[model samples]
Target chain A: MALKAPLAYETKHHLSYYECDATGHPSLSMLISMAVQVSEEHGNSLGLDTAAIQSYGGGWVITSYEGSFAAQQPINGEEVILGTRAIANNRFFALREFWIQSADRQVEYVRLTGLFVYMNLQTRHLMSIPQAVIEPYHGPEKKRLPRLAKARELKDVRFKNDYHVRFFDIDSNRHVNNARYFDWMQDPLGAEFLTHHQLKHMTMRYEKEVRYGQTVTSEISSPYRNENGELTTDHRIVVDGQLAAASTMIWYE
Target chain B: MALKAPLAYETKHHLSYYECDATGHPSLSMLISMAVQVSEEHGNSLGLDTAAIQSYGGGWVITSYEGSFAAQQPINGEEVILGTRAIANNRFFALREFWIQSADRQVEYVRLTGLFVYMNLQTRHLMSIPQAVIEPYHGPEKKRLPRLAKARELKDVRFKNDYHVRFFDIDSNRHVNNARYFDWMQDPLGAEFLTHHQLKHMTMRYEKEVRYGQTVTSEISSPYRNENGELTTDHRIVVDGQLAAASTMIWYE
Candidate 1:
């Protein structure tokens, strides 16, 4: 018998000029968008696409994310292979793993883990994953999966800036696109640090949904560029003066 | 014997949920992005993609746009075909036509025309189209091209709203994303009227480029709902109180 490869859904994506940022690298938001796209494709390949889940009056709602980026990232004009696989799941929670790697080179750009929960689309209440929906994946059950580091509690933030959520920020979900939060979080770091440093890893937790016409205030605690040479920061997003989201980012030296 | 395509190109795009607005349809900005995508794919097929054009020290710059919409637009989760073809060109001007239609039905969703000017990317000066850039396209020459109606001149503007351009609005071009102009123009109309009306047609002239951190004001003349049951309005985007862009819009009853 011939050797078989591990079961994982794959897609090839060519980076367009517009998908890049001033730095000629894919923006954080674009990275998330690509992840979402591959996940959708994976679901469809497994016969558990949006339509399949919707048949049960529910949908998969992402609850949190953890991403680890290689020191080098893919640049514009690069074609990358994006691979994703369902990792494991409990009754209410499903875990998936994703990676972006160079198609022609031995470079892995990033690795990602996403936590999603099944929810009733109408009532927005958490629900158990249907067997028919999960069966096609062949994902392991009760397998120990990668865990996300807990973000430091944010308080007494010193720097603050407000961003008015524009019409473009809202997606078909009638809420701000989750990736937009990275922009809000990073903008507070200003152009100096953002241009100088590259993100090594990040953990973001989406707490509340932001709507259009709302102003999100982003606050950051003064960074601790420690002796070990790693820079760490805590960030929070406040909407209408209420906490909407939070994250912690660690940057490579 | 065989026939050939009329120097036209097309690509099918599945409208993802994130591409849509709260109204469950693709947003105006996303529609424009799709147009840009198909246009790029068309150029790639013709061997005149961004890399190819930049190699000649030049690129195509959009000078203006005119868009017409069908009352019914494609909804989220639908696949639509985007088609574009070069209509005609002079030395400095190339006019192109585009249309968005349903994949399964005989319904046309929107039609657009874009006027482009060849320019030196470094100097931003007008240049003649290179033969290499135009050869593969096989677009006809001197055929009468579609024209956008000239926008009515603006006088003293009374009603106006100011918007501060956020950092995210800046794209790889180092300028405000052109689609941001539509949001700035429509927001001044307020939510109630925007929710009920649909844009029938619009002619927008890109007079000046807006930059990040700049504040621009959107001014609109009082709209007139005519005897034909159509609503017409004139809009101007003024940056630093100088006319940056202008447009005329007609809405379906």
Candidate 2:
């Protein structure tokens, strides 16, 4: 039997100019910020504030995400509705979905899918989703969590350099913006290399979530052969040698 | 002698909601977005593109500014310092000042004292400030820009309400964050009483600047010795207007 997904809390956020990307629309990192916000509110509505969860010696972490962008995102100052729902739960994993809509027409702007894992804060080891956490969501035990897009495999995934997390990297919500990962993931490649190549397609899979005051050391390495006999690259954002996010980018010459 | 003030080309901007006030920030009627930005990057030292500045009109317009604040007022990531120079023309007043900072510190921040005036777009009523806009800064021309602030004579003042502008009320340049003025100046009064107050002291002066979108506003009005025995309740930001910011709280309860 499938457990009934809980209707998580929803919030309305007004887009700010600082949230927009060079495309004149909200950047992908901003969407993740909204998702993270709604998820926190969802937990709060369930009486699971981070402090309380930490008290239990367990904390929530994002394991992976498979999100989709429907169209150009909202512009600054536009009110957008953010909705999050608890979709599924298992011994070690929980699934959530996020939706963003414009205030005027309630038209969808972006939809996101995320996977969360419970972990021991002290040990940084994965923990089973406690029965108490799952019971509140009214979810069932029989349904399996959906699979994420597998990170592209490469023969020469080289570990490049490390990045230090700065205070400005944290937002009002206290976590780094998701899009910032792209910066860290790309920075090691050198500014000249980045300027010379354009990202044609990129698929990022988040394996874990890093929090404030945590210096996430990223390891990026990409090596691949394209159909046209050209070299390609796959990247990884790792925190202390653990994979946090992975991406495969098709570059423009 | 005022050293030659920075000479920069004019630029443009578009206003966003985050730049607006819930109560008194820029009102709907005064929603000209790009003008302030043009002034901030007037010289375009940060490498702004021409294609971006050509929107709305060939020129940017700043209608008026009411107040000022100290350092720590600017918002995060805001591009500033372009519009800090004044033009030679009196009608196209170029009110400009830069943020003061101590030595040996990296120039991470600056405050721009901006002066603006209104002009007709179609007719170019005031027209553009020509080469002489640089005159005042070269040396005090014995010319005085209109004062934005003067101490109110408390005895004869009759204030219907107090005024306030919050920390968030100021912008990145820190001068009473311009966005806050809309809500600060207008929100204290009511729809029924809009016509009663002829603003003579709209000039707000800066002492210590508010930082990063803090909720603040100004408290103002002519003083009155009322029936409550020296009772002076000009105006307060009541929830329904009950002293939200910069309110005058009497201890005499």
Candidate 3:
């Protein structure tokens, strides 16, 4: 009998200076992109590439993500390890986990969990997961998967900014890159807060997809203490008064 | 006698899907970023890193770029070679050449030449090239350097779009990433032209540095035939009615 493919995969990446922000660390969007890249690589390694998945008339789309960051983030030009693992999947839902850490494994920079669902690209509706695509990972089928943390609604908006989505913002997936949400969500906080504070934790939920040539208004509430006494901020991306995405971020000085 | 360092340097980079556009090839901005990265690596290899150059109270700033692309472009997940060579320099200016080719050296994807000048970060004024910074490259001293192709002024604007500079667009250099100009310049062309056509040659000139929180208007002229009978377009970026950057791009279907 042939050995089964591993459920997890890891790859080494050199953090280029272009990937880093003004803080000299990898930006949140780039980190998310890295995770997405690793997951795709994992799928490809298992012979379930995009073509194979799309052949089932659907593609995987992320629904939500919750993650935390370590105090020490990897700097530009540093070599780090990116990893992803298939956790569980059912007929309609799949769960995956991701992380970025130092080469020696001494420092884990980020840890994230994402919930995904197969969607029919032509109709843009949820669809049942394909067995041929999911079975290769060997993730046990679960009747019910654990839910990701929900993003809180924005209340008492203190800052708001409007952004026009440009052409380059879209990727090969034919939609705005999901990682771009972090940019819109965080830009309203201004550079002062961004430079002085570091993101400790975040929960983001994508409610709808934003298209090209559309404008998005990102709003954020003033920093306040949460139940855990952490400095927290609530963010929401609205399109024509409809909430497209929401997130809550915890920051530390 | 000590041997002088080589005037040219080369490195390999794997093009990630995130770096590519909806067309499944690297975007113009990402290609420029890759060139900038290799040039920085070249400087570092010669013991003239950013810190060493900043010690002279100035940094290298690109004034112009002119490049041509081959019929074949590298796609995502492909490893390509990035190379840079210090061509020549004078007291106030330097010229460098860059290229991106296949790993096997069989296909030359992009060949570009950039004109650079040292600028004082605090005063934002042109400064004389520092000896310690330029001498290590071993580029011959020139009385007068060759000028890049000047961008034609946009006439009879057929399309225009506005872009709000986001915080993430700024890099560690504390200003907008220069490569981003390519996005602003090409976005107004619309997706139809971008998807069906491939950039054959381009010449871009930067006039003023764009800052955060500023809205820039990008304008482009309709496709017209040039003297060489090649289909061409003219692009210009304006800030507060002032021309910030200009470019001319030749495209092939």
Candidate 4:
């Protein structure tokens, strides 16, 4: 029997100065980390913690993310709300929604959704979602999950940077942290572009896990206008000529 | 007249998994960051915020840090208490003490002290501490502040690694974060040593600030036993053959 729980969970967080960038806004990586943290709390509230999930011989792995950011981003030292909800899931896939908002609910800073899959811990192979793990969340069962925006393949690479994954990059899961990919994906845009533009929307897909002691090349296409006339940039992370992850970002002045 | 404020300030923090290392303990860098956050809160509580201090044409800058850690450390998802108090200050130098302990106050995780000096934001030279800033803390005024352990000069360097400062490394202060030095100082030791050993004590001194787009060379001496029969390692961060920062760490199995 599933333990009854709230369909959604929310928590308050105080943004620290170290979490913000030079522009005084929360860095994208930190924002994503906050989202992940909230989701972990949500799961723990439902009594489905890492130990419980891994006991079924698998652990949740994020495959892709799609999100949008508002122009008025949260600043350092501000108290904000982090919320997450399980949207829908199937045997092989699960979808979750997340948001970051002002404490008074006056402003919406970020809205994101992630696609997840269960992976066997020892065999490193995809596994079906465990009944005990997914039951408590009470997400609707779906035969097919909604498709997220796929990262367009990188073409006409205009800039490239090589980053050697350091020991600190690996988190408790023993692989490079999922949120860290944002730093590598956008850093090659250089300080000038990063400072002048604000990220409005982003879509990222992870095809391979980056490990410690690996040098990954971050490649990006020059900023161009989309059909909606929004400035867009395409990014891809490659390791040893193999695509590790790819992302597309829409920016505004 | 100074505003009446508590001589010490304390706050509770929930340690996120991302802040911990693969060993399931808070990383040295994150522990230092937590201490810094608590001090900032302490200053803010006394109405000595950055703006208030910077109005005098300078800001507080850390010159050195010395600290010790307990055998039992806090783990991810644990709620811990962070506390800070002004120890003593002079016209040009100030010293602050910090600690991290269990919520129930049964176990002490870390105890640290930092030496600080006011620096002119424009001239980047030492400046006398402003009365408005120091008076509110109610710390005893002194003619000479206690000195912290100085980092030993690196000798017989056995291992070295190069790290490129990324855009994310620069915080709101616009320089590499003070906590980041710990990562650079210790990463060259490799994962095997880091996982098998725990940091028992550390002393670090900052000589120069690292900026964005700079590649730093982190060099370290082989671990050796000190006179107290404790394993100790010496580390230095160099940029262009110039010493930027240095540290000494004592570890226990």
Candidate 5:
């Protein structure tokens, strides 16, 4: 019989006060932090250490991500399980999936899918993944990495505003939280907008993940302003054309 | 001139959700995790590492700490400073002070004093300080460390009955926020007790500091129920024989 490939590794985490938002639930940034930790662990389990990857002249860089949060989040004292798996890998990219499940396993509070690029650390550019790095995972080569949905420029959109990444936005991973991109993507709209309009639908696709120690520009496109009075805006989270994430938010009256 | 004692070192940190509290400030427990990292740096300055301490059949453990908070706490994007000093050491114990400062030097959000003891890791019992550990700090010996004020056990305090550490109470340090003790210390009577009952007289003295991964037991003495009808309580935060902290709340209606 052919050997079986493990789906993923699991880690347990406890909720901390720092992870919560104004609503008392874990903040969008914290949800991303948990996802990154699980991803790192997934890489380590495959025998890919920082030095090992560096030695290959490339490092893993998150290219894009999509996460969906369902129901209310975990609160303080809750024991959460974070799990990740290697879905597929290619010469230049890899795809991974992560989840945060409740102890009872009855509910999945969060689900995330991310694409990462193998990059040359020195040149600060994308590079091909080495077979040495790819062969160990045993994922299929035929898998396709999805293309991010195009975002209309803010000038073309109805809402436009700017925000600077604050100190707290940076995590131990030294990167902006994946979920926070949603905030920056939407902050330009006023609270009046958020209150009167709820996010009826959203599709965020990442082209790059912003890292710590760097500043980027976030631009939003005009809302499509649908007939039912619902509004939809398209956004591009960018660090100078390394498109970080492209998203669309549909708000309802 | 002897260099003003190499006082700090660098450490990488992983941001965890529990570290931030309800106000979105990095809680006391998170501060301690960074403090522990700084403490490890202080030991490294003395040529001590985990293996070195273990080789001697004992390890350093913190017994107590006293911390003062400034007006504002650390929020998300800022890079914080971690520092420690072996202020004094005696045959039995050592007193170390650790701090988490803002990057711009604009704030010293947390000022902490820790009491440490050398103990046999296997037995989990206190042992005398080794000459090897004490000789490096180069400080005069004192019979007793500076004392912390004790919370008066009062008989007239009211119990509010609404204080509990939630799951988010746990931080990266794996403990509840020490400042939280103040909440438990103050909450029993609730804010109403504060407004109606004149705190004409109140005091809190911390004897020991709490740490991560430990459960703290708190109890308050019955209010004496004076003629004024104001409630008062004597609060004690304890673990085993160790007195963690003490406070006395008084109300004058």
Candidate 6:
């Protein structure tokens, strides 16, 4: 589903020089982090801060994320607005939409939708969403929530790579941050391909987790031409030869 | 001289989850990035935005940085105050101070000082700082600025390892980011030492640049006990058997 939300919370961020990768634009991980930051700001404004949620013995856990990038991306030293809001929710899942746009809001940079499940920090089990947590954002509380479409598996994978999990990739959660998987997915594609093509939309499905001291292999299929004649790529990650994550991207040549 | 600026330019930031490392504390690069972020905010407030600075045909280029960490560091989802100010400067170099503290400003997490030189972007040649650029900062201009204490060379090096520069390490400048050298310096120290010892203070001096696909070897000296009962370690990085960067760190047992 596309991200459609009335912008109720907005935060302005300055892109730092270090935030950019070898390319001039912001990295995928940094973009994802900015989205998460804006969402937290929105929550803090509504009194649903991390401590407030943790007070209930549970916290929000992202189950899936799908994002679409515009043709224009934010560059270093540019001011970008990161806005987010809770769009909808069900008994167990809360759907939020996030956007990164130019300072004037006239140009949108990217839009993202994330499915969050309430999980207990102690037991690490799924839990019901508390009413107090969702009452402020004023998102609809429906019984059923939409699930993100999964990326199709690669059938004729050509390129493959083995990546050693670096200390920098792992977060406080003791596992690799989900956003980092995007780097691995693109690393195998090489700088030549990434520099020529611009990413339009990408979907990430993290089925398993990669921990520190573990090595994961990534496989990519040759660029496929869609009906619209645009370029597309399929990616899959495996640990111990078991599927860990799958992703797909539509790129503009 | 140390980071003794009168704390004036301040910006509050919410550290994202992806900013943390395996040990659960904010990673070194992200901490340095946040410092840069606040410094930019300080510049923008003074009408010294990138566009305005570029009009002079030169921009602020960091020549060296020295930082010290407090015992308490922030974790994921924590709000921190990033403060920076131009304390002193000369015709060629500007000395600035930075700090990361708790939101309440009660507990300081880290303090840093950076030496910046004005450089012509096109020619990559060092240039004198324009008075118009330094005037808005309201910093004291003098004939000479304090230089950062150099990182002592390592001797009797026992531990050594090689790290191939990843494509992601390269920035828009087509070279590795200066802060990334810390990762290489620390990588050779191993996870066991990193997990136990806390970084209290460190000084880094960039002698040479590492490019993509280059293998850099890091050599670390044996642990030495200072008079104050603190631990100290010195490190040096060599590319093709030549010095690239060197660093020193003080750790508490």
lDDT comparing candidate 4 with the true structure: 0.90
**Which portions of model 3 show Cα errors greater than 4 Å?**
A1-6, B1-6
Report lDDT (Cα) of residue A210, candidate 1. 79
The C-alpha lDDT values of all candidates are: 0.78, 0.49, 0.91, 0.90, 0.61, 0.80
Q: Candidate 5 versus the native: TM-score?
A: 0.48
Backbone clash pairs for candidate 4 read: none
lDDT of 4 by residue, B102-175 (tens): 99999999999999989996678999888888887778887888888877777879889998898898887776
Each candidate structure's TM-score, on Cα atoms with residue i matched to residue i, is 0.84, 0.48, 0.97, 0.97, 0.48, 0.82
Q: Per-residue CA lDDT of candidate 3, range B107-179, in tens?
A: 9999999999999987989999989999888887889998889888888799898888878888866778999
Cα deviation of A134, candidate 2, in Å: 4.0
Runs off by more than 4 Å, candidate 2: A1-5, A104-107, A154-163, A171-179, A186-203, A206-233, A238-244, A249-253, B1-253
Q: For model 1, how does the per-residue alpha-carbon lDDT over A54-164 read when each residue is reduced to its tens digit? A: 898788888788899998999766789988988887787888888999997499898988888888866778899888887677677664555677677775686778887
Top of the candidates by lDDT: 3
Which of candidates 4 and 6 is the stronger one according to DockQ? 4
lDDT per residue, candidate 6, B191-243, as tens digits?
67877888898887776657776789889999897566779888988998788
Deviation in Å, model 5, residue A6 alpha carbon: 4.4
Which 10-residue span in candidate 2 chain B carries the lowest summed lDDT?
B23-32
Angstrom error at residue B170, model 1: 2.9
Question: lDDT tens string, model 2, A49-140?
Answer: 66767766787777666665553457655778989887777788888888888887457877677777888866779887777665665655
Runs in model 4 deviating more than 4 A are A1-6, B1-6
**Chain B TM-score of candidate number 6:** 0.88
Ten contiguous residues with the weakest lDDT in model 1 chain A? A1-10
Q: How does residue B3 of candidate 3 score in lDDT?
A: 51
Which lDDT tens digits does candidate 6 get at residues A58-83?
98777778888999888877889998
How big is the RMSD of model 3? 1.9
Write one digit per residue (lDDT tens) for candidate 4, span A1-253.
7744439999999998889988889999999999999999998998988888888999999999999999999987899999999889999999999999999999999999999999986677999998999888888888989999988877879989998888898887676889999999988888888889999999999989888889999999988888899999999999999999999999987
Instruction: Please tell me which predicted candidate would have the highest DockQ against the true structure.
Output: 4
Name the lDDT of candidate 2: 0.49
Q: Give interface RMSD, every candidate, in order.
A: 2.5, 12.7, 1.1, 1.0, 12.2, 2.2
Candidate 4: residue B135 lDDT (0-100): 81
